[model samples]
Target: MNPVLSSSEVGVKINEWYKMIRQFSVPDAEILKAEVEQEIQRMEEDEYLLIYFSLMKFRHQLMLDYLEPVTTRIRPTIDELLEKIETSNKGISGLLSYYSLFFRGMYEFDKKQYMKAIYYYREAEKQLIHVPDEIERAEFHFKLAEAYYGMKQSHVSMHHVKQALDIYNQYELYKVRKVQCMFVISGNYIDFKRYEKSQPHLEKALELSRELNNKRLISSALYNLGTNFADSGDYEQAEVFMKQAVEITEKEKLTNLPHSLFSYAKILFKQGKMNEAIQVSKKGLSAALYQGDELFAKLQGYLKALYVDAVDQHGVNQTIEYLEKNKNYSYVEDIACETAAAYANSKEFETSYVYHQKMVETQTQIQRGECLYDF
Candidate 1:
């Protein structure tokens, strides 16, 4: 077959590639990428089309990393590409500019830099007027919701989720995206302590995930269900759901395996299963270390310190420092509150008061910071 084609023909193929990425169809995307590149080779002129192709290529890499996380230490090729794009551009189209900012947000989101992700997403929203596709707008809202959720800004997350879900519900081809939006809604409900409300969304998501035959979505639904149960004081049911979630992710070698393991270990700890929790934590920590996931490693280490090993103010303070340094004020507040309760249970009123004060301070900090982005 001839590899060379008119620019319009190559553009159609690139469009198909973007659709594959949206659907998370890695195999099809990989094949389409090769075909698109072949068509692009030895072609000159049409710089606008080439810029669009380059942006799509960047998005392809983001999709790949999202589906299966990069295990080894890799260079920041996306960063380099974005820098090149910005530097060489004399006048790029509004659509290309929007994609550049949006994909940059995705890259930051993947790195767990939620604040930076939200900043870029907000910037991209300014250019959203140029994007006429409602589905693409839904995608943007969904991604913004995810960034908000990562920062524990459930209210802001819900605002975006509602917008995305409303648009996604109108399209039959967006069932996968609909499932993801439901997951975010359920997550926000969980954060709000509306476990009953959370369950139905997750159940619907699970049903949709099974109907779609998407293992990743299925595992996520199961995990969220587990969290709902655990938060509602149903440890046994939580364990059952979480165990299934962990098993499914592990069997599939999914990108969320480390997270599942860490959450499962936390559930075990809650059940007063010290030995089992410690063992699970060790397994998760090893996987996190192997994946170079510093966040999980620190989280699991804190779990071990608080439960597996003897609990002390020093260990708690160290973890609090780490979270504070990372700007994870949500976690800082949570850990501080838990530590305050623990000290209270032990009849250490002074120590409890100290942690209680710390928790209050952290909460104030979080609320003040999030106020800037309030919708």
Candidate 2:
């Protein structure tokens, strides 16, 4: 508590904090309190050291990142930790450096800057050189793999996921780690366009999630399975899985439920269930946009494509208004183009022509890497 503690005494205190932090639990709350309390003591005596402790707390919080996004304040704390990496108390130097690197890497992940996140995550892995906890090491490696996957580096992602799997298996954290890797791997398979290959992974993940009563993973696996089926035009199977995902996600208040709803709506749209598809698409688009994810393009396109079915069911006037409003949405130009053609077919030639012009303009701008929106 002294304002001007001797170097030797500070060294001893740092060692104590280091020991507690080094043994910090993964996805467990109790060990975090012990670590952060000692960290707070260090901060009380040394204002600058507070930077590193705060960053560590951020990382700890990320274990529950499935619940909340990382805070904006985490960014500058990382800046200070990296700035003071050198010429610090030797006892905490290595530990602080490790955290600085870990938090900085995660900051990139939070920003959706995937490649930069991978760079920082790799640096954190190297800094884990002296971290004795095998479970913690596994978690670091697992997160590195996730960053790589986000960057679409599939092979490297698999390698790190497997490494984490090994450690988790050794420490009997297999259920938790397995669900994480399996969900991503299932997604990777979808990325590769191997629908059949992806099913087993998703099914297994879902089964495990159910077995363990992990609603989040259960929802995730179901959603992935639904999407794969929908993308492959298996609407019947897709509907089943997607509804399951929606049920769980809504029950659990999962933020990504909109993504699931979008998938289901797309399949319904294709199946000519115009009313049902429109209802779901509107709800899904609302949630996706709320999270700042760009899903409107596809959702709007789905509604527009339903022009034919909408005319037969919901009426041409309503479909025309919807298409005109979202005529230039990105990401699904083909769908938008089809929508215009549908409008033209419905005898709304002038409105259809406007949609055609808008899609062309947006496509041209996108190809040139120019901003397409007025706002």
Task: Compute each candidate's TM-score over C-alphas.
Answer: 0.92, 0.64
Clashing pairs in 1: none
Q: Write the per-residue lDDT of candidate 2 for residues 28-94, one digit (tens) a residue.
A: 4435446456545544366445545555555554444554222212224445555555445544546
lDDT of each: 0.84, 0.63
Candidate 2 TM-score, C-alpha based: 0.64
Model 1 lDDT per residue over 106-218, tens place: 88887777788888998898899999988889999999999888777889899999999899888787788899998899888887888999999999999999998888889
